[model samples]
Target: MTAVQRPVPLSVLDLVPVSSGSTSAEALRNTVDLAAAAERAGYARYWLAEHHLNPGVAGSAPNIVIGAVAAATSTIRVGSAATLVGNVRALQIAEAFGTLTGLYGPRFDLGLGRSGAPAPGAPAPPALEPRDDEVVDGLLVPSPFAFRIAPGSRFALQGELLGRVPGDVERFDDELALIRDLFAGTYERDGQVVDGTPAAGADVELWIHGSTGGASARAAGALGLPYGANYHTSPGTVLDSVRAYREAFRPGVLDAPHVIVSADVVAADSAAAASELALGYDRWVHSIRSGVGAIPYPTPAWAREHPVDPAVAEAVADRVATRFVGDAGHVADRLAVLQRVTGADELLVTTITHDHAARVRSYELLAAEWGARAARPAAVEVA
Candidate 1:
């Protein structure tokens, strides 16, 4: 009920990061605790993000975590920021979420990330040349950073390690279609009727996650599915992503475009305190971008002592710049700007710090500030 106090509702996206010197068991416990705290703090929904082979992140299985989170909270909707198309079968996704709905009722958002094949009839986005940050309506839309993993790198070998071969990978579009059909209980393959079991009748909302004006955005638009643009992950391309989706939009599942945008944030009792907590973020980001999986979040002190390679740091520089870090009120104001610039229907927050308590406190403080925003701005400034 209190979620309505803000100009726009705020939701949470958790990576369930295991901090330096923390165990995965403890991290999982924190995930459950944070979900409960978020519900109590009046955030709209809770989303768990998936990561593979991350030493610092414990949420490799977001669906399983979603189940645990859903069971612990009473009113908040729980689901994935994404359950990877490359990782799970469409049938598996349907059955798993279908089963979740059977147990927890219909309060779920089955958000999916772009993987596998592009949607049919959707052409690739014309590549936007990467450039410096461009200010639009006061929001900093940085240049898109191209993510690469050197061939033969451990990260590049993940598919092989996962027992996946190129020829065996399922098309993203095919899985999406099959999932919809399965949910409708009308799926058939080779003249044989396909059943989604409990999933067939589940009322879970489907969503598409995108970072650019690419096929994913087009597909979401064409299908009229809810689209979540990643300002937090791809600040440079988020505008392009949202614009593309809206441009391609056709009435299908939703009568109009429904969009959510995400941001990286860190809040503390004071702006100085928040800046300190967020100081180590670049090192954590570098770990992932460097073809090594996420290392446990580095303490600010450790980060200062052991600086990342200059090139590595430079690559993730935009993320460091884009993070909304400050005191509760300060962070809240920035989030409002983000929502406004992106014209987001809702805002998704993902915060990380070396300590679990600090991370939890960040969400709590932001929630309090957001709820107290009686003088929020109206109307969007196109980003």
Candidate 2:
């Protein structure tokens, strides 16, 4: 028998949620505290996500939040769960992340995604058409509707809110090309070279975050960049996305395919306690899905008293159901299964609760249990 490999690393994905009756300032402070805790707990990395115009989420600017977190912690990698590349220019992103890498050295990563980060009340863009060469289950296939953002949905309105003219937002592939060129110091427009000075030689790790088996996955594969599948957001498509990524993989920056999978998790001392902590999750998800934008995270008592409407509850049941909630051992068991199913090189856990203490404790418990499990030896029988 051969020796078993080391356990996959565990990381954190924080939304920096503002609880009911809490201010954004307080939410940001809590984010700093959580990052510090994650670093102390032996977690591999700490990532903040970008969400604009959401009252409950304080991470509207992930790069800024990343700077703050990096300052507060001495170790543990810091980065954006994603920077919503679609809303910003390639040169700007290249410079920003390059500067971050400069200050933080090898401890910074740049996670890019196509989210538009639309502001409230902005008009939505037309749905995206799938590429003709997209791969599905080991086959190259065309999906006319592979990616669709509903009209008037928050995501569809991102370009408008960012002051982009209708149809001005560059196609994702073109944007990626520009970003690569800028990073490699080969960017040119109209025969004039463009340079992203400090970022040109920065050794920052690039990861693509995607929820579908479309362009994002394919791009990451072909470029040999790490891919992060959003099981927390699109559980139904996680497998397909990872599959698409591995299938299209080519050796570039990375020698082989590397994938990280994100999940929703809430752990407590007991199953009952965990369930209580999770009560507010369904309602919180409802606010986002309803397209009115996310409201402040409600307290457990408030969530118990103000039950979600049946229709709204049904709409978000799949997401709520996928969340891992229980004691540390139970949650770890579930996460292990998820890792096995996804074949993820790393696991990114995101937890949102009304109480910041509970949220921090959840990470502590998970890290302890996960570390213990990884250290345990495989049982063997003498023949």
Candidate 3:
């Protein structure tokens, strides 16, 4: 097949999920292996996501995982999908990535994000009810999901253990500013004027990640940094979030708007095979949305035997509906639409499954297809 030049580069986002019956040590080893595979597959970057107090997730510390991943992969850029600023201090963020840069020679991105909703107890503003699966220009634009923290969630415990007061979501702008000040050698830690040193002189990219068209978008725009919108996790409002970032953008770190949109995808030799591998996705999503953090990734048989409650089903419906699952051709078509619609400079592909081999194959198949797909249609403006 003749290869077509893709408009956008593709990257991987690793959550380092612990599969059912797998040990954390095994998960960590699997992550390093995956990063190596991604590098060989021609992926532009490999990022680690931070998740705390989750029995199913082993990447509670992305910076450390990044170091391991960087050591294993030769050329792929490695960094945080985002390190939640709420639980970590600016001094820690600076020194961690700075040290990584010193060791790895400037191939890092310090992606920052907020774990909690920026506005606490804020009511959704009245707006037109969007239809489900509204396809704009070929891209599927899902109806907005109204997210709320589970009342019985154990997240507060995670907060307490991390030395943060429970439910204390801080200002995203303040956190952004603090990171900037640290790198500029202006912020003081422990009453001493701290020099940016390694961090200040490091050649690392600063990125802001967000799920909605709110605080994170504005901060990234105002700071002139690159922004990543979470379409894979927050499908319903991804377009709005990207639009928010573009609209709020100002020339500082970057002269023009630069965006990367993410998607959940699974690819196989056939659509049915892909669907079979993706069978347990809903259950996996239910765990996170229910505030239990992620559970060990379940097997297809286990998911088939134990179904989620109707309420749980409803809570994760949008995410389930939006996931791109099919053969390589089909999945690539969907991602191409996503990239064209969002005007993304790059696309971040996240794939998860119980079998490690299956997960790795998904990326390899998608990369092959993405490289051979036809030119994307013209960009469509969202009315």
Candidate 4:
């Protein structure tokens, strides 16, 4: 198999363990330890995902955790796997990340997602206003419409319309615009480059993460930000979404479009051992597909014995199970295939395992297999 010529930077999605037996402190410590190891292991980035009110996952506040992890490690890039921008105000996101950018320079990345961090006792996040039910009923709900509206009484709405902008839509746009301005303003206003940039105002690297095409891609393209597609759970749509993004891409914020696709990965010394590590993750993926509660990682035997429902099982199984589990050769081959299929400049890997040591080892084995390429060289010569 051809080697994945692009840099294979080992990275982590720190969900900080939230199992029944683990404590918050322990979770935090795990993040610290993981960050330190990732830095030492030559990983390029150590990111925390935003989730809320779920006992099975512990990354409720990505910013807070990012700060802690940043403090604990000297070199590895620290940032959010994503911040739930659809839930919080954009300025707040800017401020939090701006602070990190100030402290860490170009090493900080802000990945934005539309999903919200649900409150502990809250229900699932409010669907993006127009859901399938509303769509099927031909509901005209509201807008900031995608296209310009005419003054005529009739409308040709293909998708469900939500409603008119009752409040400040600029605030919404400003959320993003402001962040950019603030980043630039910090340097310009202060007359000093705090981060690495020689000019004023912060230019924190920005990325928009999405599971679909359309608004997210358009926004990222227009803003000149990098794009991260969520292929870890939505594997089927990866190619289509990426194609749409590249096709629709127009340079506004970025000189050229950059796309990263996330994937579920498992690796071990042998394919069987890697398969063993993947069983619990398979079950977890099964639960997500079935809309069941997020459960703790299960033993490989337990997962194999408890067959998931047949309806969503195939899709879940196909994406979640690793073809690369056996050993180094197997993982390298699978990754090469993934790189070819997605043209992913980078891969954000997510792994869920019951044993903490095994989880660390999984990436360690893969990094070892990727051999010297995975190892971080001397620091880049920053200006």
Candidate with top TM-score is 1
Q: For each candidate, what TM-score against the reference?
A: 0.91, 0.88, 0.89, 0.74
lDDT of 4 by residue, 57-149 (tens): 677778888988888888887888677554566566777776776776667888876542222222332232222211112211121111222
lDDT of 4: 0.61
Candidate 1 local Cα displacement, residue 4, angstroms: 16
How many clashes does each candidate structure show, in the order listed?
A: 1, 1, 0, 20
Q: Weakest 10 consecutive residues, lDDT, candidate 3?
A: 117-126
Q: What local lDDT does model 2 show for residue 246?
A: 100
Return the lDDT, model 2, position 290.
Answer: 66
RMSD of each: 4.5, 5.1, 4.4, 10.7
Ranking by lDDT: 1, 3, 2, 4
Look at candidate 3 and tell me the lDDT of residue 163: 65
lDDT, candidate 2, 1-383, per-residue tens: 55544468999999989999999999999999999999999999999898876888888888889989998998899988787765676778888888887787778888888765443444444554433334333322233322334667665565467655443333667777777787788888789887678778777778888887777899999999899998888776777899999998999989999999998999999999999999888888878776666889999999889878898777776677678899999888777777777788999999999999999999999999999878888644454
Give the residue spans of candidate 1 off by over 4 A: 1-6, 116-128, 167-170, 190-192, 374-383
Itemize residue pairs with steric clashes in candidate 3: none
Q: By TM-score, how accurate is candidate 1?
A: 0.91
Better of 1 and 4 by lDDT: 1
Candidate 3 C-alpha RMSD relative to the actual structure: 4.4
